[model samples]
Target: MVTSGRTRAVKLDSIAAGAVDLAREAAEETAGVLGVGEYLGAYAEAERVVSHHFACPHPGYRGWHWSVTLVRASRARVATVDEVVLLPGDDALTAQEWVPWADRVEPGDVGPGMLMPSPDNDPRLEPGYTGGESAADPEPAEASVIRAVVSELGLGRERVLTVEGRDEAAERWLAGPGGPDNQLSKAAPATCITCGFFVRLRGGLGREFGVCANAYSPSDAQVVSIDHGCGAHSSVPEPERAKELPPPVWDTIAWDETGGLFD
Candidate 1:
């Protein structure tokens, strides 16, 4: 406990002072009996209650303060202890409340007897059509134009890809490696838009992004921006193969053993 030289004095009423003294005595007695050490010099008084703080003497228990609160009745000269409690100091080692393992589980924390439930309103999922039992059944007559567009584009029956979805995909691709400022795109001769293997996507997205079908290209089978390109452009000609050399002729002449050559 520390007090500054310029500390303001708290003018406590006589009743409050008596309560504080009673709280200190009670705290001392409790600490002596429990062998928990003695109370500090500093004490707190509020209304009719006074708190006397004690130091925790137990090993491995640091930054813990024990306190005894004493309260006085109306017009009463004497005060009685309300309760004794252990509280955390400015720097205390405290443990969080005990939680069952089940309550502490995260997304990937899987184990036996653990049940994870899907949320009712997940953004990735849409409610199934309740008109027919079979999923293969054709859509009802009241289906909207958006549903027709989805079916025509082979997008899927459950959810229709909207303009917003296309914009989001374009934004992601523009910010990724396929963007105009990327190293591969900057050094290329021509953009994917001019490449013969560039397959334009369906709908509005085709204007900005397309699939590269050039097997030799780095972006093959992958979505690329209109202005993005690699070294393997479709217009680049293949190098010619070198011609093979003719086989060498062999001599059939025989040599005589007398140091003279015989043909």
Candidate 2:
């Protein structure tokens, strides 16, 4: 009813304007006396039409308003009731607007057997032959040869990760549990790259990332940044081991037997 901001207020129709009693009657008929409380105000929607608002006194609908729209024909002196409805006020508690299931899903929300299909034009992926491999046209001899080799090895996928996708993955791994920032990495004696248990990955990410092969490490079998580390690093000192030694023998009696020079 109360207009503010950049909303241009429309003039109240003469006949439909002051029909407070008529609006109240409509609201009472739709929602009863308990539903229609004190009158709020009138809203001029457009020419020859207006809406009356009333405090909603219904039990379940808190902070709602009863709206009764009235309209008058041209040159008509009387207003006719148009419709009655309940609308939420600014502070009303209402359910959130519905969203599609696809839009509502988050990471890890898709369990086993649930499919989340990616669009064909998704920016994260592109044809393997034309993606990270090379952008050269197949018409060129070298490019055609490369494509053939790629297909023969079953490496020519329908789609491969785009540069943006690779970047996103790198960022996620760098900020994950196997990154250099965690408490375990901070306390590690040596980094993954310096350990013999670290297996370097292939391709562009290989230079700064790899999989941790150390079973004792927290990052076992997981992708880790080069600088990420753990206490189980291969370079850590080994535990002390038992040493072999000759048995000792008594010498006092033997010395007396061998030192008798006078005898």
Candidate 3:
């Protein structure tokens, strides 16, 4: 036996010498009780109590081990088995490490009753507006004065209507189906700007977008760009209805007999 800093350490050799045979016999008895195959041998170790290792017999469970622990009573000469457990050996099959439920979430897995809270420091949105006190507000007193004057003159906020915004909107319109690139617009005789059914909007946007009032047009009642066109332009003439030709005058009667009668 070996002695450590504060407590006595039971020597592994001594435990193996004493418990190995006992553990093998116990393992045999357990195998019989469990209706399993016999264990090969008992391998002993000295912990607080002595533990014995035995190889498992089940063919499906490779590299798994069965362990039986033995503890000594205060005055006892021999150690008695504390418990038996099935444990995993170094090469035994086992489940993966457990993961948190939140970490396992995937896209589209959120359903009703699932509430995902946004992070406090979201990058997409700005903090609430605090008038001039907001750090995001522009500096320059002249700039603020110009904005105020524009608002007083009935011009909307820069966010609502800006030259840059108008340019972007114009680009989008020019690239969309309502633009001159469309097949209908390509064949149209005139653009929407000159169409009688085109009702212009109010504000700066009015210069570009207008409502199509032609009931028979594909874009009827829809907002179209000023340059947009369609086959149903108001200036296009209606097709003339075909007139019925006069029935052929059949000179039925005796035109030939009349020649002889007149003679």
Question: lDDT per residue, candidate 1, 179-214, as tens digits?
Answer: 787999999989998899999887778889889898
Highest lDDT scorer: 2
Candidate 1 overall lDDT versus native: 0.71
Report how far residue 240 has shifted in candidate 2, in Å: 1.6
TM-score, structure 2 vs. true: 0.73
Q: Each model's TM-score?
A: 0.50, 0.73, 0.36
Q: State how far residue 253 of model 2 sits from its true place (Å).
A: 25
Instruction: Evaluate model 2: give its lDDT.
Output: 0.86
Q: For model 3, how big is the CA root-mean-square deviation?
A: 14.2
Best candidate according to TM-score: 2
List the pairs of residues colliding in candidate 1: none
lDDT of 2 by residue, 1-263 (tens): 98767966688986787888999989999996556899999998888899999998777888999999999998888999999999999889999999998689887798989889988898889876532445247566777877777766557677888999899989999999978999989999989989999999988888889998888877899999999999999988999999886555855444443657686
